[model samples]
Target: MTHFVTKRAPAVALLIALLLLPACAGQEAAQPTIAPTTGAAAATAADTVADAATVATPLPATVPAATPLPTATLAPDPATVEAAASPAAPTAAATRTGANYVLSLPREAAVPADWLMNPPPDFQTRSPGPGDTYRFACLELPARSTGLATVGYRSLEGLPSVAIEYAVYPSATEAGAALADMRQAASDCIEFTIGEGDNAIQAAFAPLDFPAHGDDSFAMALTTSGPTTGDLLTHVIKIQRGHVVIGISHAAAASGPLPDTALTESLAQLAVEQIDALTGE
Candidate 1:
């Protein structure tokens, strides 16, 4: 009876051990599987944690609104705009004083030695006003001028003379307009008479082609006939430079030949010198 009991006990122990092995395996399979956190997986996990943290945090009671930046825009240059707006401004030569543009006696060496600056007392004062009867009115300073300087040369023999008139205006446009008016006056006074009786003289005008100078220039010839004065001829040349205008005239007895080329060339050179002085060149 003792031997039988021992054998039964061994069989029961074996069965118990088999049942415990299966239970332990099942428990391990039911537990969750853990993966290694690395690479993209690690980054994803960090981002998820940050998102949860942000959701958990509370913002201020009044959150400020974002402001948008202004759009870029192009603008025109200021100098270009100013130049376009102010067209009346004169050239660089216009900076000179009125006297600096006039020819001085020292520089008149090109003129004949016998000729002298003996302008009549009323020469410059001869500028015509309303109802004025001045004989050389058209040759005087134009109206609306700001300043003037005049010099006249007369031959000791009293047959030929030279006169130079310089004037400045408010602007180059005004100077140009004045030049045009002088041209019109010369045209209108072509056949006019000066004085009366024996002293009376009949004058005729004709255009003369002269070399261009300064910004603009024109020349005309005037022939006058009188009983005492005989026949006399005058050549007038007008020029515009910046805001300044110049009129140069050479008058002589019509009996003599036209002024020599030397005289006319010298006068043109004088004009150029005056312009150069104004321009500071």
Candidate 2:
């Protein structure tokens, strides 16, 4: 099971403490009260009872006033009780569509200044089209996803392009299953083709070790080479936070320098922050 850290309001904390105080005190008060029967104290108690039975005690001419009992603790306020019983409310981002979570141009520091939003032909599509030959699970949307939003960014200076895909599932279990499928598929399918005929491109997949984030995460690298499209490498990272999943990919020509480590780390951090924001963490 996945666990998320949440901060509780001071009022809620005080209410909880009030409710639990009595239960804890009751448990302590309920400890065994009967004394050991084999000890000298037991004999003394028995002797006192026998003596009281044989001798009658005389009542006082005037009875003294009865001793008063201590008052009970006050009950918690009704509003405080109600608030403590209810679950935490979700944030605005959680109710909105997947597009709200995707990274944008100048708004996000992770995105390069020169990068421009340039979605591919199959953007926002739930499944791949007939001509699409990319068999990697990371490249395709899971069958159980209810919503999808994709945004791609290309650098005018010929730097690595970035693609962010956000998907929402019915539950966290389904999202986790989808992430597991992608990890398994990447491990099993080492090589694949992107197209058919003379224009077909050969690609190889290798797992990429990345810093852990969110509830679950996995990273992989795909290298492709073809007569039409020279050598190229794409680094993809998928993160599952509750019922939402986000995919981030960086693609560049293999001949050029690899994507900067600091850039990808910043992107990953941004994704985590967005997820936290959505859940009101």
Candidate 3:
């Protein structure tokens, strides 16, 4: 905001004085008068000396000029800057922005704005069962190969929350229509008792725990929450030959039905939408 600046110039001041020296020498040599005009010379001596004194005052050896120094600027640190400045930092962003390990999302990617980590470690495609709470996890795959995504959620300490996870398998590795399996294990496993364990769950439906809705490659599992207060159950799903199998044991606890079923459905809807938006890139 200041209008004027301070100046300092040790070098420029000295240069100006040097340039003036030749001019001053020519002026004095041409103007000096000698003895033939003694009276006039005597009178002009005072004038010449006075003029010389004025000129000499401006060119002292130790006199300093004032000039401002240029300000120095520092560069920004790369480590402090964000490595991946993308909507989503993952395989998709990696291809576009070329970040070594940064995961990026599409500009149009739909981020779950309301997702909660309600069940804590309670939910996973794979985990041991706990009785009081209900949890679920699944992996969504792309229509084509070379896709990758991760479970997106921070943490949970609420009545309802949802998490969506996606997987990207390289198409080059697996042939056309290749598949993989997802698993869930618990304290004790209910080995398929064939038709026997089927109806055994009929008695436990609304009376015991809430109902669950989950899907695998081909099979869909719909089960009522179980009776025990702290019963644990695991769901194991597998993918193969354009089909998937889903299995569940009656180990879910008897809370008046955990709010997990509804949450899972909402997450499914979100994950599908986000995946579609991502794959378009």
Give the winner by lDDT.
Answer: 2
- Each candidate's number of clashing pairs is 0, 0, 24
* lDDT for each residue of candidate 1 in 91-115, tens digit (9 for 90 to 100): 2644545445443322446678876
Off by over 4 Å in 1: 1-98, 101-106, 120-142, 196-198, 279-281
Q: Could you give candidate 3's per-residue lDDT for residues 37-97 as a string of tens digits?
A: 2211111112111224443445676868789899889897776565555355323443532
Show where candidate 2 strays beyond 4 Å.
1-95, 102-108, 120-142
Clashing residue pairs in candidate 1 (N, C-alpha, C atoms within 3 angstroms): none
Model 3 poorest ten-residue lDDT run = 1-10
lDDT of candidate 2 vs native?
0.54
When superposed on Cα atoms, how far off is each prediction in RMSD? 52.5, 29.7, 38.2
Candidate order by decreasing lDDT: 2, 1, 3
Reference-based lDDT, each prediction: 0.52, 0.54, 0.25
lDDT of 2 at 193: 66
Order by TM-score, highest first:
2, 1, 3
* Candidate 2 lDDT score at position 277: 65
Cα error, residue 3 of model 3, in Å, equals 72
Q: Which of candidates 1 and 2 is the stronger one according to lDDT? A: 2
